[model samples]
Target: MQEWFVDVAEHIADGDPIYLACEECGQVALPPRTVCPDCAGRSLEQRPLSETATVTAETTIFSSTPRYAEETPYTIVIATFEEGVRLTGQLRGAETVERGEEVRLGVESDGDHWLITFTPSD
Candidate 1:
């Protein structure tokens, strides 16, 4: 995994999530980036994420490799933040969710790694 990705997760675990915004084109990216993907601008800043996101897509995985078999039947969602950045993460606090549903972004740590988590907004 990318170091920047881990950094973002760590921030979330600490109650702060961030998105990288381009100082030039105003484009935003969820995972931190050194340069703007749109304008190739090197001036990017870390901005606090909206924390809440709207579910745009979802799916449930019933089968997976042995490493993830213990966590089978998990739900994954693609949620859009207020900044227009879409983030994909594991769904928590519910077995499933629908499009347009509200969810809060968070982080889950499992010893050596961090993962993005999306739980019901309320």
Candidate 2:
């Protein structure tokens, strides 16, 4: 699982974030996985994901894990893309995000790794 996430970060750093979709069931998995969670399909293929998504849910984090403890009071959001896939990323470039707000996906280097981020759009 950690390697899967690392691949996602690397892809984002390359400016081409991608997700894995099960060839048999069409279930998309962010961070790419060998098996589809929805159907247990083994043949997964890389799929292009949109750079824009809509905020579907959000919350202010007053506390966070050790990795993000220094960035408390930050916002995390669940954004849904055109691929019908939803991903969770830290919200940026806005103090507040409302449900259904449009957001553009982005990546940021966090020392040794990259982070998934989203900024308000229009």
Candidate 3:
């Protein structure tokens, strides 16, 4: 993985979810980059991601690799945070959600691996 990717994973694993916002263009980047993707600026700062998000898109998976076979019929969601950055994660502990539904951001860990999760807030 890219070093930046590891840095982001570590930050979230440490219980502080963060995103890099570009000072130049007001663009937020999750899984941060050293330079601003929108404006090619180098002034990016780490900011905490809001704990809540609104579902913007969703998909259901009926089949999967062995690791996730038991979790089939699961849903995935793309949620938009207050800062306007969108994050995609597995939606858990709730029925499939619609666009505009509220959800709580979370990180699910299986010791050696981690997955992002969004649970319905309502």
Winning model by lDDT: 1
Cα displacement (angstroms), candidate 1, residue 80, comes to 0.6
The candidate 3 region of ten consecutive residues with least summed lDDT is 1-10
**Model 2, which residues run further than 4 Å from truth?**
65-70
What is the C-alpha lDDT profile of model 1 across 71-114, one tens digit per residue?
Answer: 89899999999898998999999999989999999887777877
Candidates in order have lDDT scores of 0.89, 0.85, 0.84
Query: lDDT-based ranking, best first?
Result: 1, 2, 3
Shift of residue 72 alpha carbon in model 1, Å = 0.9
Shift in Å, residue 9, candidate 1: 0.2
**Backbone N/Cα/C clashes per model:** 0, 0, 0
Candidate closest to the true structure, highest TM-score:
1
Off by over 4 Å in 3: 1-15
Model 1 stretches with alpha carbons more than 4 Å out: none
Can you write out model 3's per-residue Cα lDDT over 1-122, one digit (the tens) per residue? 35665566566667777888999999888767888989999999999878889999999999998989988989999999998788889998886898999998877667666677899987
Least accurate stretch of 10 residues (summed lDDT) in model 1? 107-116
